[model samples]
Target: MTDSKLAIIILAAGQGTRMKSATPKLLHTLAGIPIVSHVLATARELDAAYTVAVVRHERDALVEVIVDELPNGLVVDQDETPGTGRAVEQAVASLPADFDGDVLVINGDTPMLDVQTLAGLINEHRHGGASATLLSAFLNDPSGYGRIVRTPDEPEQESAADTAARASTPLFGRRVTDRNGRVDRIVEHRDATDSELAIAEINAGVYLFGVSELRDLLPQLTMHNAQGEKYLTDMVELLRRAGSEVTVLPVAESWLVAGINDRAQLSEAAAKMNALIIRGWQLAGVTVQDPATTWIDLKATFEPDVTILPGTQIKGATTVARGAIVGPDTTLVDCEIGERAVVKRSDATLSVIGADATVGPFSYLRPNTILGAHGKIGAFVETKNAQIGDGSKVPHLSYVGDAHIGVDSNIGAGSIFANYNGVTKSETEIGSNVRLGSHNVFVAPVRIGDGAYSGAGTVVRKDVPAGSLAMNVAPQRNLEGWVATHRAGSAADVAAQAALAPQNAVEASAEQPAERTGE
Candidate 1:
């Protein structure tokens, strides 16, 4: 690697008319992160001495995001002279006057660029001692891209591998060299002649420049192109004319430097980024059953042996520990899933599931809910602002909110902690070993002590002492034959009459079988 100090300049001033949105193109998101944020993160990985973002269109919003991601990064505004050259000039002007280092210029829209490639580019530039180095790639169809023009190599400079490669297939671009073998300038497709248009090698729009040389040449840039913009590609020709070496490094993987200009390209980039993230997790011992349907945010973390099923989205600082199983259809946001925990077919946010806990076949855990180890919030359950202790269970068909349940408590099916009254919300507390029966409702501002038991269908409005049993059901009473008297011919009356008949009455009726039914 080069020992020279590195500065990264990201150009984000383009008004992406093709994206057809009010939001700046760099602010658009891919894989739940802003495009510019990804580029900034890559630059940080390279440990650049100074990182600068040049913004003009949507300047304030773009600068805000840049500062938020990289608080110490410098932000420069490109002046009204719209061109890539002017953008880089503004960034160069922001740097310290005495700074002399290698400058890496990249597009804000290319989020897929990686640190390794950039390090390699810097090394190549330094090794060759070139004034300027261009990153180039060979595309099958090089439409709307600037074509790289390379002068033929001298026989003495050509290696055996280069000779064989060039001889086997006609090289992508025409071999044009002056008397001395040197690279020519890159020509935009519109400016190229008929023969130049056939060249497949295109400029990838990423460059490494010697800072002192670039600063000197920025003033000489002229807007003589058909688009009426000061072209950065012109620098290559100017450096060559100055008797300085210009180098070109062909990137093996073209996607690394591909730029996003429109919606279709953005989507394409997103898909590629998602695939790359998924592949990384798979290599790290996390099982992603169907990578296509699973979306894991860049900020999320997963430990070894975590299994993520299909249709799952883990987002926003969520972390899953080893042996945890999440999703067949689940979304978890800002939540933590502990070791051996299982969360399936559920949506949870801002919660924590302790080790060995299980939640959902269909459940919702809202903000501030904490489920302790070995606890379960079963199917059709919803919990909010609740803390359930170890071994506690809200089995099914229940809502427990603003509540605290101690260890070993069993909340029965069809039960609810009625935390909200008409006026305001309150909390319920259940101590250890409590048995809350089915269809029970514990009204807010209530507590059930340790070993307390509640009867089925109870409505608990008051606190129950330790080891006590609480029931508020009305006393049972039998209004004999009331249904028969009230509705003579109804189904209730007919059932009542049959139930009232004696056991011997059936035997007696069988013995007298000859009676006329019509009568």
Candidate 2:
């Protein structure tokens, strides 16, 4: 990089008319971050002394995002006179006067421009001793891009003999340059002549200029162009006219210089960004089962040897420790997964799972839910603001909230911590080694002590001491003949009659013997 002091000016003033939506183009997100945020972050990576972003359309919204991303950065609104040159001028006026550092100017919508390229461009500028440096790309169909006009000292010498060779040569996407060392001028596609339109080199909307040089040349710009705007590209011509070296840097990875102007381009840029992220994780010793189906956030992280399964979205600062297996249809946001734990087909937010804990084949863990080591929150379970101790298990089909369960406790299937009493949400505490039966409901503000047992169908409303067996106090009763009576002449009645016939005959025989003896 350059040893000189550096600052950056980001152009975000365009209306993005082609995006055709109410949301500002810079606010549209890819990989969970606003687009200009990516550009700001990349710019900050250069360790610039200061950074300024210029905004016009949607200035307030763009300013909010920029301040959040780069808190110390400056945001200046461009005045009504429209042009990229005017935007940079407004940004430059915000910086310290007499600051003779190199200023990097870039478009905010071009988020895919990486830091390495910017650093290389700065190095080229400082080492080449050029007055201004611009990044350029060679596109196969460079329509709508401003064409780079090299000095005519080197004209095309394509002879008839080599015409076949020139056609056969592939220029699909590669950087080719000449030793001209300077560009004469730049022509926008709308204003270019037929001969100039055939040029493959196009401006990439990234430039490096000496601060004094930019401050000198910007005021000379006029609204004489087709758009009646003062274009920043006109500076290249102004610098050349003053006998200054206006150098151009050709980037080999052209997509790094690509700009996002519409929905289709946004999608393409997203795919390219995701591909880079996935490959980075793969190279870092994390196993990604299906890269195509997984979406990992820029803030999310994984330790070495973690396995990420398919159809998963791990977003918002979520961290998975070593040896953890996650996904195969799961979403986790801002959560922590401990070492060797397995999370399958679950959705959790703002929660933490301890080491070796098992969560879900289908579970919902809401905010503040924390499971201790070796704890299991199994299939179809939902938990919120609950703390379950080590070796405890809420196996299946339960809703646990505002509760704390001690170590080695077992919460049976279909049990619920009835914490909400229509208005007030209450708490439930089950002590260590408790055995809670299926279908039990713990009405809250209640506690079950250590080594206690609760029978099935019990609704616990009060406290139970240690070593006690709590159950409903009602005695069991038989209502055997009620179904037959209520369902008379039906299947139950017929079966009941058939069953009583033989018994009735035996009773009659005994009665007859008794009668005979009496006589």
Candidate 3:
């Protein structure tokens, strides 16, 4: 068997006390994935001989997640969150017994670390004849970072007692009167003088160490600091006393070592990572309009020539294929967009849009909704649990829920497959070439046969036979000559009343004889 030389140790054992979260801090998601996942992905790109993650808090959940999702890697439990030095010691137990090659030590929260930069640091360490090499950077604000110290030259000793005195106050620690000025001893930020605090160079918390050298020096670390923690920085001083060479290589970018301990910092890191992804995609022919308004999860895929317009948030395992256009303002979750499909101003969840299909300027495709090839879901449409057939059109003002539209059918404006009847939902199936009119409602469990025509305002309750026109309204009739008969009866009654009126007047005059003579 060929001998493998390199092993990677990831420092993930910290509980992230500053994070103050119930979820393991390393398991916290950034851009739709756990933070440690990004770190593991970066390490995998290096093709290290072995990868070992040092885990402490929430070990079981982290193990399951890493083992199931992450590439094959080893996990070692630190059991106790003692310190970074102790964490590495625990992981070292899992390394091969006779391993003698270089080791890469990295922090799990530093996902921004690029494998190329890490590889370059390791290469420099191997060539510098140094026992260890640190990935260092000069930050304008280096408050919490350890400062890198280097040895200059040895001073002449007068005698053995003098050597003991000088050893008590090493020449490296003494202020050197150089041509420029007196050089102060390199000190950590907490213990540094005001002048030393002004120094910019800092440890990046990433290291490349020779395995044998680390094995020898790890046990020498003591818990002597104010925090009662075994600091890895103190090992640098120890190695110096042992006459071993240590080098610091400034990281090409300072953000490579940035770690997240709080929500705000996590957000900042996520934004930076997303910006990197967007820039890379832009350089690769993917157009992301208004990058600030667009948020693409890190794992989401966009093929070449795909355009993501402003206000588009493609997240949660979604992928848009080549030539597709998504959103002037749209949200997609766990979805797949086919080639050249247009999903505009829509919200889709667990949905798939087929090739060349067009989904609306105002539409919602809920879970289990699938649009067939070249299907159109026009403006103000909503679909749930529906399967739209190929070349079918569910145009304006429609809710196609719990239904299946056959190929090439035209679902009219204001048409609704009213599949819910208070208690349960059912399916409405329309065959090919069925022309549904406006204001049509297909009640639950009804199938419209092929070539069936429904007039406007048709409420289809039952299945219509093929080639039949189903109308739900009654027939109308016209009435004539009815008014003429009623008018003739009124005229005859008026003449008979006039004839009776004269006789009545004569009888009245005879009843009063005196009045008759005067007439």
For lDDT, the strongest prediction is: 2
Candidate 3 lDDT tens digits, 101-219:
98889999998888777877777667767787776665667787666544444332122133223221111112211111111123556766665565565667888788887788898
Give model 3's TM-score versus the native structure: 0.80
Off by over 4 Å in 1: 1-4, 151-183, 189-197, 475-519
The better-scoring model by lDDT among 2 and 3 is: 2
Ranking by lDDT: 2, 1, 3
Please report, in order, the local distance difference test score of every candidate based on alpha carbons. 0.86, 0.88, 0.79
Superior by TM-score: candidate 2 or candidate 3:
2
lDDT of candidate 2 over 63-114, digit per residue (tens): 9899988898888989999999999888888989968999999999998998
Q: Please give, for residues 179-243, the per-residue lDDT of candidate 1 as tens digits.
A: 22246788988888877777766788999999998889988999988888988888899898899
Give candidate 2's error at residue 214 in angstroms. Answer: 1.3
Candidate 3 stretches greater than 4 Å from native = 1-3, 152-193, 418-425, 455-459, 474-519
Q: In candidate 2, which residue pairs clash?
A: none
Find the 10 residues in a row with the least total lDDT in model 2.
Answer: 167-176
Q: Output the number of the TM-score-best candidate.
A: 2
